[model samples]
Target: MNLNQLKLFYLAVKHQSLSHAAQELNITQPAVTKGIQRLQEYYEVPLVHKSGKNMELTRAGDNLFKIAKKIFELDKLADDCMAEFHNKGLKHIKMNASESFGAYYLPEFINRFNLKAPKVQVTLEVLSNRQVVENSINLKNDIGFVSFPVKDRKLNSIEIIKDEIVIILNPFHSLAKKKYLKASDLEGQMIIMHEQGSYFQKMIHDLLEANNVCVTMPITFSNNEAIKKAVEGGTGIAPISKKVAAKEIESGKLVALSLLSTPLYRTFYMIYHREKHISGPLKQFINLIQQ
Candidate 1:
């Protein structure tokens, strides 16, 4: 079977119209029709039929569509896997980061790195700060960006940056008008929370617990972005990293309030296995980060 023709057939079946498939594939409508016709000729069975203005798949076409979906998915997966193979003097760097750094900083940083070394490929995985620390200690990732300092003797931790955690609020929320928020000001207020066991979440809990302040937590999210969106939609207020709220704060889409006289902050650490080799591309990346 011709895979190109099969691709066209899959697209046609997916969109339920040859013309629509043609538009998606950036090919002419007649090309899509011919491609499907070739598939039918090869199988000696009709694959599609017209009813009014819509196209419907035959029994054989339905079966082929299911198989085609799996085929194309695997094909794309293989392409991605092979692209990551280390060869031709190109280096692949594995990075594991906390959600905030991964979402807010890494993309632009990686783009800049790409311009500096086009051949180096960096794969990033966003996880909880604890997971980031564990992966670095276990050598599961080459580098880890996490909020809390690492205490493990097997890993080397370098202080990267300090992130100030701020109280996030909807633009029109009652608290948004406050220049500074106190622990007592937030008592009994609805709040969004982070996932359990998160380092920053622990800090927030500690700060609140220390002041004997309690808030209603209606929902929890695993990442900073989701929590920000929930707060933007007026779900509730949350204490989050200023780095994560920079854009929203600047645009006035969200308000970031200071906590009374107490400043909440978390230090980000760059960690790696002590025994891991630092050379070539990895060394270059470390230099870039340090700079």
Candidate 2:
């Protein structure tokens, strides 16, 4: 089958108008009609029949339309793939990271990388730790920064930084006066928890359970900013990364206190698919962050 004729038929069926297809294809209406005629003649089946001022596809046309749709879609994808290689200087790096590293640390590294490779474009998304790991494993992102060490053999996980998690409370809260708090200190206190099933939430729960500490957790937030805002509003105290709440702590809107009995610390890991080719822009970003 002639692809040119197939494309004309596809477009005509897609729009349900021969003139509209001709307009888009930048050809005369008769040319489009002839193209469709050739396709129907070659296939020995009526591809389309005319209604009152409209074209309707026959069963064969509908079936061929489905296959042609996929063919053109793949054609466009091939074009895009080739375009990327053609514009070598305009490289793109996609990164998925946990909330803390994405908001606090990745920006500085991206800024530095921009100074070095101005042509490279960096796209960053803040996701949960598990989402980051999943994106890395699926090669959806060129790199990922996650809160916990990934044990997947298909991924290369490198420890990037160690962050301390501390309890943050409104400056006016009674617990704000304490230099340090124990898990027992949190007992009976209203706690603002991370979203259920998050790695951070699990870690906090494990710590509290290990110490036999129970706190009233009535509110949950998926992001640190919301948790900090809630704590500042005196809704409840929250356990979050110190760096994440540094601005609030410095402004006295919140107070950060370490856990005396079991200090919470989490290491952030830089992860990427083991088989992923280290492109120049990706390598530069990894190096800058590692340094």
Candidate 3:
């Protein structure tokens, strides 16, 4: 039988009388009887009968009543879950981002979000910019954050934030004394870089190559934290987002130098599947970052 009929049948069984069931359901007794009849017809079994002026359930009716009770219980649970998501708050969110943004900036956004929704669960995956784009295009994540603008049309992207890439140097280095650094000044100087495949490394190389500035890179690390530590230890210098090295720069543990040739600025983008529906929590997160 259909769900409407099943609900009527359930109400009839709960009240134990067609007249009482109809009164409670705000329907005519004949309507209740018709609904029960439809259920019995579909199941090909007698659901109830009168015994000495009292309604009693038949053997098949007892089983059906039990099943109907479970169905309504589950339906109530589903309603409660959806109500919480729609009205009170969201329960979960999945996010993906590149290493620099995820490590340096996303945590602040998450902290702000937690202030608004303390109980909501949020998980973030730190990957490469290319990986972030792929995950967004594949709908594997609810939101993607990347350091560079994503050019793919399959994914909708918007610039969320902007950060400057500054030349990080040891305070003891000679170039650190200069207010402005020329491309030729960095020539032949030791440069600590991120892993070879990193977009930041590629940008640094491209900018330097275009300026005819070549530097030696003897150390490469997979993460910004390690590279920052390497630069602090006077191993070499690197060009990284100022946001990533903000603490070090503020603490005087790292020195930031501006390039005289061309300013290095990176714009981070938020991406998602063009057709994917953004949930409440995801939308709140986007707003938090944008703010």
Best by lDDT: 2
* TM-score-based ranking: 2, 3, 1
What is the TM-score (0 to 1) of candidate 1? 0.67
Quote the positional error of residue 261 for candidate 3 in Å: 2.6
Candidate 1 on 150-221: residue-level lDDT in tens?
889878899877778899999999988889988889899888988987777788888889899888877899
Q: Can you rank all candidates by lDDT, best first?
A: 2, 3, 1
Question: lDDT by residue for model 3 over 141-253, one digit each (tens)?
Answer: 77899987778876788898888888999999988989988888889999988888766788888988998887788889989899899889989888888888999999999
For model 2, state the Cα shift of residue 2 in Å.
Answer: 21
TM-score of every model?
0.67, 0.71, 0.68
Measured on C-alpha atoms, candidate 2 has an lDDT of 0.86
TM-score quality measure for candidate 2:
0.71
Which wins on lDDT, candidate 1 or candidate 2? 2
Ten residues in sequence with the least summed lDDT for candidate 1: 77-86
Given candidate 2, what's the lDDT at residue 272?
87
RMSD from true fold, candidate 2: 8.5
